[model samples]
Target: MSGRLRLSLQYKLFLAFVLIIIVPISVVTYVTTKRVSRQFQDHNRDLIRSIMEQMVRAYQRYGTSAVAKMEKASHSREIQEISARLSLTDSLGTTSIFEALTPEQITESAKQVGGPLDLDVFTILTGDGTIISSSHYPERFGYKNAKLLSIAARQEGVPFLIQEETANDTILTVQAIQRIALDSATKSLIIAGGYRLLRQDFLELILSYGKASLLFYDIPKKAITRLPPGRDGNPTPFAQSPDLLKLARQISEWPNNPLQPDSGAAARPELQAEISLGNSTYMFTGIPLIGVDGAGLGVLLIGLSQADLYRLLRKMTMSSTIAAAIGILSALLLSILFALRVTRPVKELSRAVRSVALGNLDQTIGVTSHDEIGMLGAAFNKMALDLKDNREKLIQIERVAAWREMARRLAHELKNPLFPIQVSVETMIKAEQRTSTEFSTIFAEGTQTILEEVESLKSIIKEFSEFARMPKPVFGPTSVNQVVKQTLLLFNPQLRTIRLIMDLDDHLPLIMADKDQLGRLIKNLVSNALEAMGEQGSLTVKTHLGSPKVPVGAGGTSSLASEGAAERASGRGIEELPALARETWVTLQIGDTGEGLSEEAKQRLFTPYYTTKPKGTGLGLAIVQSIVADHNGKISVDSAVGQGTTFEIELPISQPSLAGTETV
Candidate 1:
């Protein structure tokens, strides 16, 4: 948790914008693409089903036209004459139509009628369903046409599909049967005619309507035949495509009573499936082809290529991705611009506040807008101006109060000396007037007392003048430990009866200070300590590098290095203080195990002309305070009534030049 990174306003804003813009766009693009792909697939399925329906309609029309042609051929003169002859009986009842006409004449007659009708097969059947004469297959003359016989018995003049088999192959045809009336003694004769339906031709016709593949399932042979585009050869077996095979099987298993031609069963529902062939995929619709008598002939599968639809979807997805990227980039750019615009004023305000904290109380910042930031800037400027004015007034009041105190203390000291001098001079005048023998002695003593008192007044005046005329510090790189060691030498003889402890850090860095002024400050503190200790207590002095005091918890203090202190100072997180301001300090502490001063005495310890000593002029600690302040340092004292006293001073390792000092 302590190692967590701090994010600035600009980056936070950028992230927010990215999530807000990109998330919805991504979601919408995904959903829309999916929906479009699904719709495209559905449309393709419908198209395949529509194509199959068109083929079925075409086949029905072909069947209807074929039936009409056969009906027209039934009434033709050649067919009528052949039927009339077939119905005619010989004089002897045992002779039939076959005996009445030669086989050549009978077949030739059927051909003459079938040629104009454009029929593939024209045949005359006996009452028992034997092919008496066939126009297309003369060799089938003796074969029985059982399908025709049953269809004739049910209903004649209606077209129905039939399969005629030969040694080489099988042929499918749409044929209509017609019965011609004869005498009661002679049985009725039947005529059958139809046009041949080649599977290849039918597939070709279906393909001509659209760009699709056709698979014909032969129910009898249990085989699926594939008719691809632009192939003129016979259809090949299509066993590799499992999807198409499944569709074929599903259609073939559809419930229907094929034997009941007139049962009026409901039409089968169209089935659609998708199959892949080679590198391309297709959508197939299975259409069941029904024979005329409602028999399950086979399933005709029509497939429409889905390559175009897939290609379109791919293009759409690519387009969507590119668009999303552009949108995100645009959002990023806008977010950056916005974040900079917003944070610029905040950064300026921060710098201004730092300047104010560093004692530049006249700091002012520009107000660019009427927004919250601008309002804050305006408030800060006002506060700075007010503070500067107030500080000037307060300084003036403090100066007057200090001068009043100085005058009162100086007057008090002057009164004490003036009284004695006045008394002595008066005594000397009386002695001279009396003209006694002891006049000389009295004069000598009075003169001596007067001189001594005069000297006392001069001494008090000199100390006051020195304190008032204190000079500004000449800052330079000076080692605090060296100065403490040098000053301690002056008090060595006086410290013979006292236990002296010195803890000076060797690694302490040099501080910017006046060497002479630092010597004086240390001398004053040591003098005070020796005076308070008198004869027996220990006097201790220490010099070391010091860090800022940081608050650890409630009512607790912890010391940390400059870097850590600066970071801790600004609770907003990382360090906000300038590097120079956060530099380390050198500390000097001097303590005495003497009768410590009371709290009131400690409070006014550095005040000028305040002293606890009977004959002391209290300017030493005050002078020390002034010197410390001149070097941009701080001083503090910790004391108890009887536990002793200690003075701690902290000075920066380096500092900017003093405002009115000459650098050495």
Candidate 2:
């Protein structure tokens, strides 16, 4: 009632996809977004820390240079040399500076000591803290500067000085109080005057430096200015950064004790990490440049920012997240595509099978891919066609089998009656009862005719019954090689006239069958071969082994076995010449050298009682065909008009019981 269903799997798959794949993917996308966000933050923080360390290193270099400047200012070696020329005896003694050096020579020596520590203002102080050197102005070098001298003298070894006023910024007053040499003994005197702090190079250095804010103060005139401090305690850094100067009161004394800003102080340098300048974060560092004599001269302050660190981190995280998402999405999409491509065909084949389950043999799984799936689709089509054809063939075979069984039954049932009738007819024909030539001739002729006809009738009934009622085979394990050998031996007498060849492989597995049926199968084939060859022709028996074709249950089937031997042989009997036909069949190929029949003769060869021989019963071939059918074997006659005939019989290679085949 159904016109062939032409629906494709894609239509059904549309429904299947909704049920299986689409919904879960939506949930996966939602989960992935949240996971991506958390990973971004952690990645950026690590990048910022690395940039901060680089800034720290740069700050350290500027600070160390300031320390070197302080060392040059405070070596104290030049001060010791100046003190060596002067003499003083304790608080009451005095020594003549003129004895060590004239004014011109002293002035020249001062010029020779060109640095901050070796200044031209080389002067000597008396034991009573009086300046005695002529290098300073006469009024400026003595007790008139008692306040500065007393500061150094009272401190004994410490280089103490008050700041001196200058025309521009200021000068340093370094008065290192020491003992003056007198009669190989020491007296309380002091050597001073590296007070001229404004070396031009030093001034230039103080101005060029940034970050280290300065405060230059003149103790004499109290002239204070925000001058940037140098490594030496001079006016440097005070002018560098206005902000640092504004916060001077707080930062002038750096590494400030307790570190925190003073209470009620106007400016408080709270030592900030100056996070950034120009969109970058920076660090502010302060290093104390100590004099060689261990006085806190001044400080070097720096600001190093790291905003680039933050920017780099932000860029890195954003880029990394985008790249990661793209990669993961690409992988996911490709995987989905690949999986669907491979499984699509399998699903199509599955649906096609379901249609077939409902007895839709015309349904086909069309080719979808060039790979294995396409091959499977073609194979399915072939299998469906084969199954449909085989189904029809089975019906025809059943009819043939039924007819054969009936013939065998009829042949069996009538043998009892046919035997006695034949006996009576022979006796009647033998008894003499002729009176006249006409009467005697008529009686003998008539009796002979009746007897012959009855016998013919008997023969017909016997062969038909035998053909119709074929026997069931009793099966057991028997060697196929042995069966072939024994059957050929039985035909040994006939073998003398015909050249025989045997090509059989040993080590063949045993087959299951009934012996008498198998023997009769062989007998029919051999007899047919003898008839085909006429008198002397070659006969060859070949045997080969392979895996048995057992029935498989698949594709709406429960028992799908191969076409077995007996019935197949019976069917093939239809395609033989009428002359030498039929026999019971098995897996024995009995070929003969003789003139063969045409295609037409081959087709009608196994029809009931069909005969082509002069004196032979056609029932012999028919009986052979029926017996072969019962045993599930086949007999096929392959021949050409002039060529010899080959009757290839394929039997179920099962061994048959010896008792069952005791008589064929």
Candidate 3:
């Protein structure tokens, strides 16, 4: 298992993916939940604080209008008419002017000053409290001991906020109470009105921060408010958890220490904080209300439940998850495609190797890619090519080995009988052994024929033996022009009949070549040329140094230069040897206007034992090819049956040297 584990890139890649993204995501989830959520909560609280200040300013403005209306109505036309009709004595105080004008009349008159509302709008002075109006159903009119209202009436800059309660029952209402002067009277009246709980403006302030709901409560005063209760409109109560209630109470009493609590102090709650009310959780935040004299009046509360917070969180979470999934899937598909792209060259190399294993040495896998894997693929392709080349060399070597075996057999088979024939012919050539001049002539002919046959056998042995054991090249600098000249000079005895034309470049650079083998190469080409010419044609010997100047076709040589360094080194695996071959080449083209060879003959001309002539040993051009190849050169033939032949040989020209000893 461990060994298999060691070889997998997939496991390594997975580890990389985890390291790069998953671990970081874990960290982010922790920090965002721990640190960022609370910060968001703080931000929301600041917003609430700002809203509280705005509310204070708005209420202050509203208070001015309410106060002004009450003052003006005291001195208005209706009140003066009522006063005249009553005919009360001057300076009479504490008069009950109720029978003349009802509550409806007061509401009508109040509407003329402000906007319209409930019809039960009237003012009454009780023993210790005063009532301006009641939106609720209540009848206690003449006297009610209400020190809450009385204390708020005298000496105030802003209105006082107080909780409203029924005489015998606990009424959950918050009241905004204030004292106002009627017609500059030295005595003042306290006015109050409110509904049963937190107003619309405060609920709206809590709902604006994201989708969270906040609920606040007072532990001491036990004051609480829940907004937007549920889908159906109903108020939800605060939950039974002490910690939550405590936090809510703390929030409600903000800007004041609830335990000791500063005077005229208030505190607002943070946004995104959740509070449970009833069975459901609500989110909200609130602060304590302060009086105009910097005194702590009571705790102010606000917030909603938890259902909506989860809904918003799920929405955002789903969107981000889908986006992340799409990104990962795209990466997955791309990774598969890229892996295939990376592995294609390797697949080709594998196929090529299989082909080679099956003995098909001719298959080639082309180069691809530029990265490390691509480089490796290129190297594998090179190995395949080398394998193919070595296979071909082995086949060639085998063929040469088989030819040697055949030669050994043939030489052995004919040796004994040919020796007897020579002995008999030579004995007959002696005068005593001959019966007449005719016998002598016949004897001479027989001996000559036998000697010629023996010489042919010797030539056959020599050719195959030389081919079988081609000598290692002794590399040195040599001039190709001189080699060509010497080869032609070796045929100098026959130079009399053949029209020999020599054209050679003077400055052909020295090339690394085998001296004796190169000389033999030129000799064989000249011999083939002479043979093709028979006894009477022009033999043009041309020598030069250049790119593929050899009369062999330019097909393979040009590919060497164009295919670039690597292919040029291998010479494009061309069948015919290239003149310049692996480096600089000296070109020798020997043309003979003789009985030219056919296309078929040209193809097989350099092949060992493949001959067109009846008496020809067939090793002439074959040896030429072998020697030229041995020197890292090439040999080829071009011919027309009647037009004669051209033997093109390219040898790596080295320093010029004298010819070897002639075997006469």
The global C-alpha lDDT for each of the candidates, from Candidate 1 onward, is 0.71, 0.49, 0.53
Ranking by TM-score: 1, 3, 2
Candidate 1 per-residue lDDT over residues 1-664, each given as its tens digit: 2356888777777778778877887788789878887887777766665565555555555567666876787688876675666666642122465676676666686788777777777887766687777777777766788878888898686677777654345656767778766554557767887766544566677777566877778778768777642254455656567777778888877666322344332234356667888888887767665676676677767778888778877887788778778877877797778766776677777767655553456567877778787788889889978877876787689668877887888898899989989998999899899998889998899889899999999999998888878887888889888999899999889999999999999998777789999999999999999999898899999877653343221121111222112333332322443345444667788999988877678667777888889886898888888787666566666677788887777676765332221110
Highest lDDT: which candidate?
1
Instruction: Give the TM-scores of the predictions, in the order they appear.
Output: 0.62, 0.36, 0.40
lDDT of 3 by residue, 220-326 (tens): 45655445555444446654566555665555444543222233433434323465556566555555544433444444444434454455556545655665566
Report the lDDT tens digits of candidate 2 across residue range 284-360: 43333233233444433444334444455566556555655665555556555645765566666665653443234
So what's the TM-score on candidate 1? 0.62
Model 1 CA RMSD to the hidden true structure, in angstroms: 8.0
Model 1 segments more than 4 A misplaced: 5-49, 76-213, 217-225, 228-233, 236-239, 247-276, 290-297, 314-555, 558-664
| Candidate 1 lDDT trough over 10 residues, lowest sum | 555-564
Residue 24, candidate 1: Cα error in Å is 7.5
Alpha-carbon runs more than 4 Å astray in model 3: 1-470, 493-507, 535-587, 593-595, 639-644, 650-664
